[model samples]
Target: MSEQLITPWAESRPLPPYKGVLAVDAKDFTGLPAVLHAPVSQMIPELVDQAMARAGLTSVLQDKRFPANTGDGIVFGFDPAHLPFVIWPFLKELDEVLAQYNLSVGPRIRLRASVHVGPLPDEGRPDDGNGTPRNDTHRLLDSRPVKAVLASSSEQTTHLAAILSDRVYEDVVLGGYAGLHPDRCIEVPATVEGKPFAQRAWLFIPSPSGNLFRAGVLAAEAPGGPAEPADAPAQRSGRSYRGNTQNVREGTAVMGDVSGNVSHTSGDTRYTATNQHWGSGDNVSGTKNTAAPGEQR
Candidate 1:
């Protein structure tokens, strides 16, 4: 080798192998008393084992599984082949496992999870599953959409909310390998805090819990929030939000805390109309709204 060309590929750098990345985070984990941290953290593996068994993928984490602890959660990598199973029975089973566990625990554990599939580098450390996919997994877990789903739901019923990368949604759910119904997934954006990462992702809730309302999945959700899917109404039966019972168009009564404005009227009303008599006890006025005689008009 008297002379050698300094070409880019001359020094072969092998590509990292593709892996299925999963991140599960416990909501308000730090809010729990310090004495419970170790016990709660120890239960994670048990929860995953139960979930894996229920999904019939007992070997999903058998070997080379790198689990990184984030104090309140874990980020792990496994064979991509098991991803479909993870999405299917695994997620639902995890929800059930948490629910069953919650029945006995004083401070229940609720989770936000994300799933992604891509090339992942061998970790520098045992728990450090390195690569962009790992980063993506955690970002999706921290995304606003997924957080909103959990925030909007009653803490008692909804045990988990998850975000799936578009790749996983297309490859596993859409490809029908996982038996997971595509309709159960909601489209949302994944954005990382103070980072330039943003992408389309799919959201899944094992149980909608008490998050449902007339026209929104989250309370005070912006107009740009997720569009209500066509079949959503049928799923709202027997669900309650906050302390209020949802009765659809029949009527709804909310007695819990409201962070936003609530308005209603019995007569034909225009939010921007002036000098119009609209029947209402509590209503929002965007413009000039006439009131009862002797009252502020």
Candidate 2:
């Protein structure tokens, strides 16, 4: 017999309209050293699916595609009400999943989530055949608290740190274009077992080929000290990319894409030093030429 499809309680049953949007970004996936890239990419969607299931929320993985340089990735929508109970715990699951692949979550692979609450249009495309909302409408499925959780960008900050770490290899990179917001990075402090840990951030790399890849923490500072002028690909970095956003400032490392779109921004910086250490050709440990299952290389 075929397995029964599980529907979210919110979908199957009548529910009040929710009031927030939760945007999630996988942590340091792009900067993962080859050893960790495949596994993290594979697990991210699964963990997200599991969180949605546990939250009794309905969601659909959208059709948006990342740029060519990025690795296998997934982006789905979820209800905001499930933030604390479902989303956050689901992110924590990364620790165990990474271990199975001989990887650790580290301060790097943590995720970043942004939540926004406002008037959302009711009419939009359907995300699933089940008659669920699509596009930005799905964002309304979350609650205020859930929205707050997402806006906190906690997990995103952690992921950003790992992205900034040169030791980590990324399967995807985003935002490094000439006319976009370069500060696509988010910064946040993290703790483990009651101990203070590292801060995290992210970077958006916009390839000239029109593909967008996101690097976590390691992305901000290139592996070597400030890139040499001759070696510098004509990429732009700084707050000016953000346009008129007053929140951004100089020395912000915030940059823009070729078309001048705003990326993301935050204030974490631990991955800079750590990644430089690992990616500096000193620790070339791990299986080489081993691509993750279902990946091209």
Candidate 3:
């Protein structure tokens, strides 16, 4: 047999802090025996590359750390701005790939993904590095909210659950352009080994209706806490974090004689139906007539 040689990274520059760190682990992969590891290890990189390319982010997977044959997952440190279009869409495609694999085989190769933004410390290995942010991202995969969402999705058509750190939510998803609704995300505390890791990470699942997963409304506590109260008000409109709402149907006021009115607000102003009359006490401004009765405005 010939002697083997190992190559190093062409650019061994010091690893810098990344604005967003993505960590993903195959759920229940450890329970498999050694023989099964090789297939998963070999397939993951290809799957990741394909998914990233599909999302038009082919470069994001280039320098990232992928799991070895015995390892359990992959880690990526990238620009925070990519979270909305690049990373989020990549995850959606990734889920499709994994779900297809499950359909091809008998068992599902579900993935639990977590995203966080922070400084990353160099581990001296360009290929694989670990730091506080990466660890927190991994620990977030073990969070109760993530696990619960994953379990809930098992019976559904999709088998992926993504958890976003508070910073990612506030800065990216909440900032806009993610194509995801804030109401679809629920704040959940991320805990690992019975200790709190992230105080208010957001959890989301692609909806089974061929849309993003539904996280439903969540309570204000860590995993295994009390359920949402019965009196919690339901969201009547499909309003994203900072997006505009277009009312298509007439809204009925319970106690007032305002009749039925449809209203929508985009920025700094509110527009209502012309048929409806609003009093000064209603505090509504900029009423414009864009639609007739029973027509979307």
Candidate 4:
């Protein structure tokens, strides 16, 4: 039940918006088996190096592990747009290579991306160690618009990934506990051989980091309506709302016997007997002696 923590990848570094350009927070990794709880700390660094080498991007990155307060692990970050197009192919290749180690990419190891078109901030060089610049308020203000966009993108990607991946993949989306919101979400139905698949869709959550978490799977179904009304009578019994008695015959009262047998009785005399168990057998009984005038029977 780990959740992801959201923090600025770089402190005091201004990020500006660019059209058709994306920023991604990516981590390099080889797959590890589920039984191994502690993975090599060098795994992320090695992956990053491999990505940089393949993309031919000459950039310096800090080698520090930012530990979570809860002691889960640390998160690494990089600028995706700074890397060459080969970055994507490199990751795919890494996945194939790691398969040999009986490890692949960790499910939780994903990139959050953000794409925006806007102006970037420009940082000035330091002066003669005097009052050069107390703070880069200019860059901070300029990067605000773009930074906000990227933050939103990361949230959307995380949410979509959570919904699409299998239940086991929850570890990835949940992160180490800081819940994020998803915006600009899109769900597309999945198909096989040009035919629709039942309860399946493709989700897209574009992060400012230029990272897109993609997966294919079945979608969750909506629950059915409430349970049927409990007042419904049993189907086996042919009794109506007025009880088992079908048609009224004079002043007879429809009585149900111990075995649920229905019969008609007028006063102290049984007129007809109908045994439902015997398939509708009716027996005519003797009628009560009619009392003379007002005399009681």
Candidate 5:
């Protein structure tokens, strides 16, 4: 006989409806001194509550539906219709909240948020929000594109780095419903470490930080502490060179069919982008005969 496809409890409950999912996690939470961990962890929800109040999302918080904490962060599952609200006022309000908190508090608080929409069956949902959508939500939150946005930026200036699923990006941002501008978002590959997951996603940063800021007098204070040249290569998404190719950002990173080594000056490390897909393949040691992926140097 074939194995049962329907579980006993699931058969009785009506199908769960698709829902909007949003998650926020602190950057470098583990880097804090152990003593400050408790106070910091305790503030995640309180700050969220304050943001909700500002976004007028207090009703959902009152319902306390699908709220889960992932040690250093929190997740909220809600009706898909509210996704736009979460994307706009909620995210903006949260960014403001974090900026204020970091200014007045010790152990600066920076965050990475992910927005997704999917079903969370009543009975089958994991206790800590481990459904596929929420899992993907976390994967996006942990993805390097988003992390690089935060990492490459100044923690004091950059408050939040948010990732959006292609669906949400289309339905909310591109649909002209979100306060987030379309041009501000960059497409990226959303993947997880040690996990079988890959998808195209979008990234948004509310405030400019480090190397991502627009060029101007402010550029001088950006990550590298200097303004970039007018002829610098345009920023590319995901890994470098569009393949296993090395992107020579030192002078010219123009894409080509041939493989070559790349080098940079002392301060040029700021321009050298680390490939999130297969790790950094930059040949900065000033040597010939670089090894290919998985080969001994």
Candidate 6:
């Protein structure tokens, strides 16, 4: 007999809306695929499992309620209420584990992850049918700001660069639950094709010393002297973002595109994209996907 579909919280049963969505990607995945892909491909799932366990949330994996799948990376959902306990711990452990794995192996393993809170498909519903907040979370991962953090930190002691949407930062992180301070968050814009001002998120780098949310800790520990200011605009090839300079770089890094690569420079690694401008605006066009969240009974 065919196996029955096991729906967590029940099929068509009222369920609480997903409080947040998290997306992760291996850095420079295509750059050194020959050397890194095989090992990275093998370790991602193990890291995910360990991270979930570290957060004391192995049930989310067993029950299949979280719907986390790893391809080149991973994406998962969790209750916003668990932000302090669940997601933070997961990232903390994941960072350490990835560091350990990289040390044990030859090549370094780094990740770019994003977190956003919004409505998502209800339990038992199909995610592929709509773009949902989950996709938005992925878009944030592709944003230049996030890539900038990851790229610039390539030569540093940091291994993970995480971006939190403004909503998540303002609501949860700033609310004082995760022990993450507001000053550590660097604001940046995210623009998607056809979507103006499509991206706006905050970036945070996890430190090797285990102080995940402390600003400047990673830079201090980095081999290179003090890096860019925590709040400096993402610096691209020939330009930067500041006041009304208009001398900004524009680019688009489509989500899930294997061809995309992060460009590295002597000062800071530049983000690869179709355009080079990183300006402020909500004037761009194009609609993204979102799901009508469900309420738990």
Q: Estimate the overall C-alpha local distance difference test score of candidate 1.
A: 0.69
Error of 4 at 85 (Å): 2.2
Cα RMSD for predicted model 3: 15.9
Between prediction 4 and prediction 5, the one with superior TM-score is: 5
TM-score of model 3 relative to the true fold?
Answer: 0.60
Comparison by lDDT, 3 against 4, better one: 3
Give the Cα-based TM-score of candidate 5 against the true structure. 0.69
Per-residue CA lDDT of model 4 for 148-191, tens digit only, reads 22233343233212112111112222332112211222222111
- Worst 10 contiguous positions by lDDT, candidate 1: 273-282
lDDT of each: 0.69, 0.30, 0.58, 0.27, 0.67, 0.58
Task: Decide which is better by lDDT, 1 or 3.
Answer: 1
TM-score each candidate: 0.68, 0.28, 0.60, 0.24, 0.69, 0.61
Query: How many backbone clashes are present in model 2?
Result: 69
Weakest lDDT window of 10 consecutive positions for candidate 4? 128-137
lDDT over C-alpha atoms for residue 6 of model 6:
63
Error (Å) of candidate 1 at residue 120 is 1.1
lDDT tens digits, residue span 161-263, model 3:
8888888888778988687766567665454544545355777765332222122222233356533334423552321222212211112211111224445
Ranking by TM-score: 5, 1, 6, 3, 2, 4
**Per-residue lDDT of 93-180 in model 1, one digit per residue for the tens?**
9999999989983679898989999987765655356667888888889876688668767878889998999999999999999878
Question: Residue 138 CA error for candidate 1 (Å)?
Answer: 0.6
